[model samples]
Target chain A: MTTFQPLDIVRTSATVTTAPPAGRDVEVAKLIDVSKCIGCKACQSACLEWNDLREPVGTNLGVYDNPHDLTPNTWTLMRFTEWENPQSGNLEWLIRKDGCMHCEDPGCLKACPAPGAIVQYANCIVDFQHDACIGCGYCEKGCPFNIPRVSRIDNKAYKCSLCSDRLAIGQQPACAKACPTHAIMFGTKTEMLAQAEKNIGVLKTRGYSKAGLYNPPGVSGTHVMYVLHHADQPQLYAGLADNPSISPLVEAWKGIGKYAGMAVIGATALIGAFHYLVRGPNKVSAHDEDEAKRLAEAPK
Target chain B: MNDKAPSGAPVRVPRYSGSARINHWIMAIAFVILLLSGLSLFHPALFFLSGIFGGGAMVRWLHPWAGVVFALGFLMLFIRFLPANLPELTDFKWLAKIRYVVSGRDEFLPEVGKYNAGQKLVFWSQAALVPIMVVSGFALWTPGLDFLQSTFGIKATMDHRRLAAVVHAAAAVTTIVIWIVHVYAAIWVRGTLSAMIRGSVTGGWGWRHHRRWLKREVADGHVKSG
Candidate 1:
């Protein structure tokens, strides 16, 4: 039996660096192994606890998945996929942690209307602050993983931040640390890539032909990497996009629309006010003023 | 269509009841709140508006309830207004030439009864969206009704929220635009707000703005004096 390091048992304050200089490069992360995960959901719970995210309590959807999917409250999730293997004549269950991949060209970052709602941290973890986020679906539309889920209460956008606070404090993410089998690991992107390649080679020797790493090329490479056992492609995962690309239309109109709408209404109002002020007495017809005075004096 | 007082006495017809006004304003306020909150949450970048509900979590918690409140308010209006909003054969007669009302050409507008073609369009379209949003909103809120909801907890998803959102927002946009037109018409012809606010308009307002309706009300004995 493996021990849960349980960060709280020997609790200490996070010794985090306040800031990284402009020229300092972001250290990216990678964590996953297809064969080892038993789909145990300790990672999900730990993530919620570490981040001060609310505990999810609700009816389960097919698996032990509760609260069903990611929401404003729950940012990280484990996706379960089942497939029939062509080579092995047996079925297999594939589990991948479904959260913000913290892509190099982050879609949520691109689509955010606020300046700092979804942001990159030292570990290339995507972070969110409730105060900054608008629940616009532009991030939902732009993401290849379809990671940004809108909260029902205020319609604000929400998704994984890769447990940014942990990285800041010089600690492994709650998800990776709680993962019993080391199925989820965290490290520099380069080291993680090296380990992923080696793991695939070992699986190849073990005669798993379809085994491969997955990080869609067009997504600017997700910080969270995956190794999969497949009878098919990576798109088999839940929430995977058919085609992923940034919407030029959104890019063009996003900021411009708000200002444009304000300007139109403001200009119209100003002109109307101008007309009223400049042409007030003239605009009021002689018949109208006489009738108004008569009604005012005649009325009780 | 004459602006002259009726031969017998005068004209006084109630336009909107107190219940109708109450329902209308409630729906309007709720719709505006929902729209602002929804816009703030639509994109991570737009997250700045979360402050409207105090912050992000508050927005997340309150958005659904706001939707529920807005829908219920609209339901009250629908229950009260549906009968009047029905498409009468005569309604279509006025539809083709509604532009005349806006063009300052009083003579060209059709012999509109209580509501002109423009008003009729706003009323019916707004009424239609209430039920659509209520049904869609429920399906969206209750998690287990659809299998996708069962699998992904997508019940409260942006997909669901946005569907109702589009309808909710579209209805609001149409309503507000119509409101602008309505205000312009009232001022253009005179005394429109007086009837709604004070429950009476000058004889000139009723005759010039709703001539056909005024004539019928007087003939049917629904009006006597203002």
Candidate 2:
């Protein structure tokens, strides 16, 4: 069992005050080499077992991928995409493990309305605290990747924790440890980037001219990076967002909108109060009552 | 309260009936409930408000039903007051001299009716924004009802959901501001609260603020004086 430690929380949800900057630590990262993945579901099974998640038996939806999509139970999934290169006249099976990207500027943390529901550690792990969750699903709207899932049974938000528990005990994440081909590697971000560059060099020698890393800068580069053979066309590999970032709408709603709304409401009430103080209540004068009485007493 | 100003009693004309007052109060109470519940979910600073509704889950569950009650009550009010609130020629003149009305110098303003230009503005704003809150609210709510997704033509895509969410929050903020103005005006104008509570205003109140309406009522022989 992983013991609880005073985590160096770098970000917290729905908090106005900035978090104390005491927990500065070396950032960690997870690199997934898509080219080496063989469509094996070992990582998915490992994630389920380690997380103790019992995803209900689901039906075949005319696809090899089971459970259809990520759910409250299924935190990690293997997405398979088959594409044929028109020039080579050959099919390419692109298998990618899809889960939380653990964005440096997480949109879910920005959008969550409940304080402390979602937090990002100094080590680049974004975790959800269900006790603080309101289950309003604002995080879904805030997330550009749509990673969080709200459970109707528990009425709390759920998502991948990046196995923060294991990391605390100095153990590799279950998915990365279970990767048969060493496709998933976990280490400090600097080390992972160096490894990713070497993997790209190997792919370049194998005639993959467009091979590169999929660490989109839109969300300030994700902690979970992908080394892809066809990184030039990430969308070809299961709709991997070519340029993913927080949506402008989410930013406006969470950013200026929050402050502006409070200002407008406060200003309007203040103006009303001022008006009342300046000009007293509009009262009915005694002269007006006499006039009404005179008019009512007069009959035709 | 029982009968319309019996003979030899202080002159009091009926404004709202018993049912009308009940409806208005129901709408008022529901509006307050929805505002607190919705704001609690809007920002973390106000999340403690969820305790009033039992908890976060209860707030999430009860918000929509409260919206339903508010919508139904507002719809009835819309139908009941629409005829009185329609824009007329005097309303334009009244709006033009809004300065005098705000400054409590109503002698320079146009003679008003059952509803003034300011009151009409509140009614019309609620008319426009309540439906917005209702429609966008349904879109944001992701309960077990998948059929509702098709009803609004929302494809259940993230983009559609995001747009609906933004619109809903904006409309809610706007509506709350208007509500504050409405409540403030009612409090500022003495005798206005009685119209909604006891269902009548003093004849002096009618004569001073709404002389045209009072004249019409007297001409129609609907007045009695002690």
Candidate 3:
């Protein structure tokens, strides 16, 4: 995958200090309405075909989800969750298309050590430059969603680029384009948010009183929004974290913890050098040699 | 090798065996490689070190594997030296006069054994931290251990892996600092490096630094005339 330098990146991994020049690039988003989705795997197939990825076909383990969970080759997946609504006495099939959330505050970008390995564009799409990835899997550690995958074959990190290639040419993501029920909506962030609100209102009239958009604020809001019927209970949808934030451990590790480590290493070396200079090498003196000889030659 | 003994010179006691010296060097070399590669992946400023390992991809591939080798070598070293490096009551006396040791004023210090308090501390610290490196390294190697999810029912979640990465990096930084002290101490105590390099130390060097050890070696009739 080659970048055309088309992205006007606002933030980059491991180079957080330098801010990119301010630009007027409108943010884009993909909204998936969980209430409308029928558990069709068309989006997953479209993702595979468009990305040109050959994720190995595998047998199912008691579920409709094939190839089960996400992998390096599988960028987008249709996650199926069978939820039983206790109050309504109905079995609701909650199908969510799981992929990179493309957060405004991308934890993957924050945790990545390799420069240019992960980048966030002005349009709010988080992308991984595989060529620059060391495959150390820091991005995996950084991601709250656990999105990035490290491949053993190339030893490079990978994740959903939000179809950055297609978007560069004014085309929507393959998954959104292939949606049969128009469950997945793609447009400018503003337009998508408006559309999601309108859809949620219609869902409210249809008895989904709690229907709302899920643009999690913990990540400062993701470009990928979810219009959920049971929005208050996101965990009902296959352990989709109700309050996903970058792990505090990751924040410390990538934040002050990084500098503290550097300081400790630096201080140790400097102290060693200073000690060597101030207090010279301790050499064995002639008295010590004489003492050793006397001891060795002593009568037993 | 630098300090060749003259004819009828002072007897030299065996400090390390040839095989032990080889093991030490292997561990040392592997440690350096791991430090460079790990640090390269640690921060952007040192990422250039990835060049030494061929590239970022290669470093990523090699670091944890190299860690395995280092860990194995360290395990051998730990076992071999454990009896000697075990803390004794006299080690406290040695620790009490740490100032004298650092300032090269050993007259105030206690008669030392095969290893000093400092060496024992290094041994124990590494013993404690090496396991952390291995366990955390395994957790971070996501693609390599995806099988665990199915086989052992270990869900390698992002938060779990994230915690592991932090612990791994933190432990590595600590190990590197400890190693710096170990290397510096070996050099500052003039004849020490040669023990790992040549597998022996001059009787005089041993008597001055580790008098009790030299006495024991001589009493055991293992001393060789230089």
Candidate 4:
């Protein structure tokens, strides 16, 4: 449990004014080399043990993945996709680790309405504060990658924090530390990028022509990246978003729409007040009372 | 059966029934609750308003329930008032001379029915916007969405939830503006609040603002002359 200082936070949800930290922290990243992975479940177990989470035992649905989908307790998952290489006519099993990407611009942070519910650290780690969460699930809608999962029991959202706790204590993430194949590498972003480049070079020499890095620029590049053999089609790795970005609808709702709507509401109230003061009340006149009396008397 | 006042006193004409007044008030109160709770979650500046509702979580829990109550109350008002709120040729004329209507120049305006054109506009616009609020609101509701998915095998996708959020917020803003207009109109027109509060208005009030409606009440013996 590392104590976080105000200077550690780069951004906070629903905050109007946030001063930039005095100095920048060295940005860190987790690089997953897909070609070197062996579909082992050590990372998942390590995450559970390190986080002290106990996910309920679930029945197998005839798949290699356990607990079918990401849940509140299960922050990390191994998604298996069996694809056939058309050129080589070989069936290949692509296993990808699925969790929060911790983007430079996190949609979850943008859409959160509760003040201080979500925060982005200087190291590019996005984390949620359960105490301030209102359980509205707006973060779920804002996420382009559909990472955050709102727990039914607590009504608070849960997702991977990229092991910010461990990182603060100068240790790698639990999943990265537990990877037996050294597939998940953790270090400064520059070192990881260089390492990914070296791995991609080795992969190309082994005849994976389309191998490349999966740090999508749509969300200004994620701290968590992947080196995919078929980077051109990330969907091959179990429905990974090809071009992930915050939805335009979310942007509109949280961006211009919010400010404009508030302005219009304020203007309407002010206009009503001004009109009342200027025009005064529409009172009934004496002549109208006389007419009403005469009409009542003359009526059959 | 008429409890008449002394001679030379003013007459009173019935406008809304007791039940109708009660229904209207319930709807009004529910709308107010929704507005405060909704505003608390809408912007950071208004977040302090949540303190009245206990906190942010409380407001979140109360908002949708208040929405349901509002929808039910509005539904009754819609059915009861629909006959009187139907658009007429004079409604267009009244709208055309809206400037005069606002300036307290009733002579330039046509004789109106139980509801004026502005009131009718509030009625119909709410009738259209409330359903949008309810449907989109359900999509954004966490428990509601879960129940829908688990019970009916209807899963609301993230895209659906996103669209619902935008649509709900837009409709809420429009409704809030319209509500402001409605409340201000009541305050601007003297003797109008009494009609909803006591279920009757003075004959002079009807004659000044709604002569046609007054004449019908007199002919039908709904007015008690003193």
Q: Return the top candidate by lDDT.
A: 4
Question: By TM-score, highest first, what's the ranking?
Answer: 4, 2, 3, 1
Provide DockQ values for all models, in the order shown: 0.12, 0.48, 0.55, 0.52
Give the per-residue lDDT digits (tens) of candidate 1, residues A144-164.
Answer: 566777776765677766665
Worst 10 residues of 1 chain B by lDDT: B1-10
- lDDT by residue (tens digit), candidate 4, A108-173: 999999999999988889899889998899999889888999888888899998998888888899
Poorly placed runs, candidate 4 (over 4 Å): B1-9, B150-153
Tens-digit lDDT string for candidate 3 (A14-112) = 763666756847999999998889888888899989988988869869987777888898988888888889999999888888899999999999898
Q: What tens-digit string does per-residue lDDT give for candidate 4 at B66-131? A: 999999999999999999999999999999999999799998899998888989999999999999
Whole-model lDDT per candidate: 0.60, 0.85, 0.85, 0.90
> Where's the lowest-lDDT run of ten residues in candidate 4 chain B?
B1-10
Better of 1 and 4 by DockQ: 4
Count of backbone clashes, every candidate in sequence:
25, 0, 0, 0
List of clashing residue pairs for candidate 2: none
Superposed Cα deviation of residue B203, candidate 4 (Å): 1.2
lDDT of 2 by residue, B136-187 (tens): 8877787523546566554567876777778888999999999999999889
Best by DockQ: 3
Where model 2 places Cα greater than 4 Å from the true spot, the runs are A1-7, B1-10, B144-147, B150-153
Residue A131 accuracy (lDDT) in model 2: 83
